[model samples]
Target: MTAVHVTPTEGVDQPTVLPASRRDVVLSYIALTKPRIIELLLLTTVPVMFLAAQDVPPLWLVVATVVGGTLSAGSANALNCVVDADIDQLMRRTSRRPLPRHQVSTNGALYFGLALGVVSTVWLWTLVNPLSAMLALAANVFYVIGYTMILKRRTTQNIVWGGAAGCFPALIGWTAVTNELAWAPVVLFMVVFFWTPPHFWALAMRYREDYAAASVPMLPSVASSDEVSRQIVIYSWVMVATSLLLWPYTGWFYPAMAITLGIIFLIEAYDLRSRARDTEDLSIIKPMRLFHFSNAYLALLFVAAAIDPFVK
Candidate 1:
């Protein structure tokens, strides 16, 4: 006699899986928020707050700003994931993102994003102030729906104009501490705004093919590497020059740090230029190294500003 075995999945209309499925879903939800970028974004704000306060900010206020900013940024990223899901599917770098990987449902991601945005707004308004809350809200709207969706697909100048999205955090942090905007924080805001293009175009040069494949119109993809390289160098110089101006508002510590960091940024851009001029496959080693260092450099430069307030 022969016996027939029935498949468990065959009997059920909806599939059942082990516990890992649920855990993965939870993890996917978190990844949809792009935590690394949020961390870097939050880091930009802290030093500004410390400097604006002329020392360190209040402990409770610092905590509130960080938490509120993170939530708003995370919410923006989630919405970004939702809107850019199509382009994201094409880019190797973005292929693993939550929506692209089908790890998070688009509707679920959108709803979660809106909910986080609401919570962040409420929290910041209550704890920080209405102005700080407004700044964060504007940033979220600008980054996710504005840059990632509208401008990113439309033009190479996207990041340049879109740079304003990231600048708001400095404003938010400044207002969080001072409760008013000033020339000093405005300078900080412009520093980050100008820094955005070169920092990103460096990465874009490295990922030109990915941007091309996705039709994402990164500056490097739209321009010859030489043009991209030149722009990167120009922006790096401007960032360093602007950074030096902060010395008048702060002190010797900032100017000193500015020189050291500026030279390094110039050297990195020069290397990128030389490599792009010489290489066929578009050597990214130089740009990749610059991109990595630029992250630390900007944060450290800003940190120096905060410390300068107390420097003896």
Candidate 2:
């Protein structure tokens, strides 16, 4: 990632700068939002809208929701960078973020985050509905406050509960189309909720030292390999079980896909656990295998959900 040289502003006594291009500055701000994470969140969003509408929803609404959701989630992630900037500099994995690298100023990022939040709220309220807007806003608050501010450094179970913030996209998509909540989206919500710990713990396992160095209490950072694997297995099973709850709501294709993906996810989880049990070497215990697989599992499962409505 390239960084831009910044001159000292009126408020800042000393400003840091990195040599970067114009495109780099734009990309740096984009990175602040954690765009890849937003992709996963939006994946859960559009499909639930499909399941909620029982067909293809309005394209304009889809576009609007996507834009609004993007802004809302981006705001949360950028603010998270602001809040975690101190420890972010300590963690190798996060040391290159705009804030830590000085690609974007602290005050600039803070203002950017707040501006995105306000715009997202009003955009959703006007174009989508108040319910969807409120849900998106609530997710932002939970992520920025509950997850980043309060729970993250304080508890080992941080992602376990903080993960709930990620689940709201399911509800937001459903309400975007139907303007109401329903059981189908609720089931999807629980799937993501349960899926969070195992999914995130896998990444944490891979970056254990970085997390430990930063003093963040991510489960894998604080717990023994056995304990972390145990929790991963537990959460994996719960996620798979919650996925099956969609059986009644979705058609045959969805259940079939769900069952198959669930098995794959479980297999990956079991493999991680098996490797951890058999080996003491952290290098041999490749948790990222599960991490990458979990990403595919979610993308495929949600895409299947969207496709199932048409086939069924």
lDDT of 2 by residue, 153-260 (tens): 899989999999999999999999989998989999999999999999999998897788777888888888888998999999999999999998888999999999
Name the weakest run of 10 consecutive residues (lDDT summed) in model 1. 1-10
Structural RMSD, model 1? 8.0
List candidate 1 segments past 4 Å from native: 1-19
What's the TM-score of every candidate structure?
0.91, 0.93
Deviation from native of the Cα of residue 189 in model 2, angstroms: 0.4
Segments of candidate 2 deviating more than 4 angstroms: 1-21
Question: Given candidate 1, what's the lDDT at residue 155?
Answer: 89
Question: Candidate 1 versus the native: TM-score?
Answer: 0.91
The candidate that achieves the highest TM-score relative to the unseen native structure: 2
